[model samples]
Target: MRSIAALFSMLMPGVGQMYNNQFVKGVVFLIIEHYDNVFGSINKAIHLDFNGAHAEALKAVDYQHLLFYPGFYAFCVWDAWFHARAGADKTKTAIIFLVGGFLGEFAAIFSTHLPIPSLTCGLVMVIPMLAGMFIFRKQ
Candidate 1:
């Protein structure tokens, strides 16, 4: 069940929360995710920047709206996973998730300035996040 919820979240942020019967949170996640993806503004900026359209990409980027995406996405996944586990401990879960989500958001913000590929930076951020998840896992 936990794995399924996690997997569902991987597909889309809120589905796992819905699976866990967290309808309100799931809706919030879905709304945020949809807002991030619908216009694809950030994504378009990234794509354009990657393709060497720096000025156009800068014009396309919407920092204010983009900031909400990473944290929300990460939080929903972590929240859903915790809820999925039958006897999961809540201790420190929020902190661990906050750390992970912030790191992810930082990566997203830095990707534009850094010479490294965004995907690579995202993968780098995931290492610590995965480690933290394991480190804080229910015993």
Candidate 2:
């Protein structure tokens, strides 16, 4: 159940909350997700990034809005996982999300130096997140 919830969130931010019976929170997250995507040009950037148009991808992104995305994404995943876990120890979860968020932001900041700057942020961010999930599952 917990893994399912996390997976739902991984697909879309609010879906897992909805699965957790948090309709209002889920709706809010959905709104935030849309807002962030549009303002950040995240979809456009990712498309360009994957197409190897690194310059265009960088130009497409609105850094101010994009910068907030990693933390928000991490939080949504953590929220669903926390609820699904039904009061699992929060310390590890918090640490995992926090680190993921920070690393995501850090990667975004330094992505300009990488060959695939736009995609780098997402890749770096997801690494810790997936690792955290596996770590939690083992406990």
TM-scores vs. true structure, each candidate: 0.74, 0.94
Estimate, for each residue in 38-107, the C-alpha lDDT of model 2 and write its tens digit.
9999999989989999888989999999899999998998888888866588887778878888988998
The residue-level lDDT of candidate 1 at 88 comes to: 74
Cα RMSD for candidates in order: 3.0, 1.2
Candidate 1 residue-wise lDDT, 9-116, digit = tens = 866889999999989988888888888866648678768768877667656767676666678767777777788877777766666667767877887677567554
Candidate 1 residue pairs in backbone clash = none
Q: Predict model 2's lDDT versus the native.
A: 0.86
Q: Which regions of candidate 1 are displaced past 4 Å?
A: 46-59
What range of 10 consecutive residues in model 2 has the weakest lDDT sum? 85-94
Q: Give the 10-residue window scoring lowest on summed lDDT in candidate 1.
A: 116-125
Candidate 2: stretches off by over 4 Å: none
RMSD of 1: 3.0
Give candidate 1's TM-score. 0.74
